[model samples]
Target: MRELIVTNEPVLISYAEALLKDQRIEAMVFDRNMSLMEGSIGAFPRRLVVSDDEWAEAAQILRDAGLGEWVVGNARK
Candidate 1:
């Protein structure tokens, strides 16, 4: 899997997941357990990960949804 978006905003994570699902892309949210680990303090950000083969299309979907700024790493480079 490859990282798609890493963010502190839980809502954005949910929204992105839904968008990806609509596009038939499977995604997983990493660090979600951090909320329990940190006592729901929201300090540790969550990560959205997609399969290696689906990353490019998933990133484009996110970008089209006006979430391009939230993407992380060298996926675009």
Candidate 2:
């Protein structure tokens, strides 16, 4: 698995996951708790996680959906 998307916004996280799922790419969200923490105070950019294997695929899935660009393997360069 790999990280498909990372955002403080829950809607973006859920949207990306659903979009990637349509492509058969496994997607997950992490740092969700950080949102609660931030909401209590004030912050942003909470880290999200996905399986390592799905990194490239998930990133591409998001990209294709016009979500945003992400680093993946050679794309990291």
Candidate 3:
């Protein structure tokens, strides 16, 4: 799996998930429960991840949605 985006903003993650879903791509949000460990201080950014096979498509969908700024890692592969 590869990370599509990582951010402290919950809304951005939600938006990215929605966009990916709209394109028939399934995404997994990691560290969502980290809030419990971090005392809900938004210190740990949630990670949106997808399979390596789906990374390109998922990255394109997010970038098209104007979320390119939040994307992480080398999506080109």
Candidate 4:
């Protein structure tokens, strides 16, 4: 899987997941347990990832939904 977005905001993660799901893209949330174990201190941000082949489409779906700024690395632009 390729990491797409990393953030401490749970709402944003959920929103992004929903958007991707609507487009028939599968997304996985990583580090959710770690973040919870840390008591949501924001130290361990959750990661949204997709299969390597789906990464580009997933990123574009997020970008088109006004979440371009949240896409990881050069994918944000």
Candidate 5:
């Protein structure tokens, strides 16, 4: 699992999660408690997850859906 961003906003998180879900890409968000904590540059909501064995396909799905900005590390084909 890897973190792609740190946002305390629920709406954004939900949007991303739903998009991933519709594509049959299983994912999980962590640092939910950080939402309540004051994000002081470091403390922030972390969405932690991987694309299973279907990462390549999922990456394209995400790109087509306008989430290409979130791809982390070398998500190679």
Candidate 6:
């Protein structure tokens, strides 16, 4: 899997996940439990990831949704 976005905002992650799901791309948020365990202090930022094979398409989907700023820089290939 590859990392797509890393953020402390759960709402953003949820929105991104929904967008991906609408396109049939499965996304997983990592470190969510860790972040909660850390008291949601924004310390352990959560990561949204998709399978390596779906990274490019998922990134493009997010970018086209006006969330390009949140997409990871090294998303290519």
Error in Å for residue 32 of model 3: 0.2
**Per-residue C-alpha lDDT of model 3 across residues 1-77, encoded as one tens digit per residue:** 89888899999999888898988899999999999998999999899999999988888777777777777864544
The candidate 1 region of ten consecutive residues with least summed lDDT is 68-77
lDDT of each: 0.90, 0.60, 0.87, 0.89, 0.63, 0.91
Find the 10 residues in a row with the least total lDDT in model 4: 68-77
Q: For residue 15, give model 5's deviation from the true position in Å.
A: 1.5
Candidate 3 segments exceeding 4 Å error = 74-77
**Candidate 5: tens digits of C-alpha lDDT, residues 1-77:** 55543455677667777877897777788876664576445456566465456666656666676766665543545
Per-residue C-alpha lDDT of model 2 across residues 1-77, encoded as one tens digit per residue: 45455455667777776776787765555666675766645266544456777676666666667765533342531
TM-score of 2: 0.65
Q: Which residue runs does candidate 4 get wrong by more than 4 Å?
A: none
- Give residue 63's error in model 1 in angstroms: 0.4
Error of 3 at 29 (Å): 0.5
lDDT, candidate 1, 1-77, per-residue tens: 98999999989999999999998899999999998889998899999999999998998898889998897754554
Q: Which has the greatest lDDT?
A: 6
Off by over 4 Å in 6: 74-77
Per-candidate TM equals: 0.91, 0.65, 0.91, 0.90, 0.62, 0.90
For each candidate, C-alpha RMSD in Å? 1.6, 3.2, 1.6, 1.6, 3.4, 1.9
Check candidate 2 and list the clashing pairs. 1-51, 1-52, 1-53, 2-51, 2-52
Model 1 per-residue lDDT at 19: 99
Q: Which one wins by lDDT: 1 or 2?
A: 1
Q: After superposition, how far is residue 61 of candidate 2 from its true place, in Å?
A: 0.6
Off by over 4 Å in 1: 74-77
Q: Write model 6 residue lDDT over 1-77, tens digit each, in one string.
A: 99999998889999999999999999999998995577767888899999999999999999889898899894544
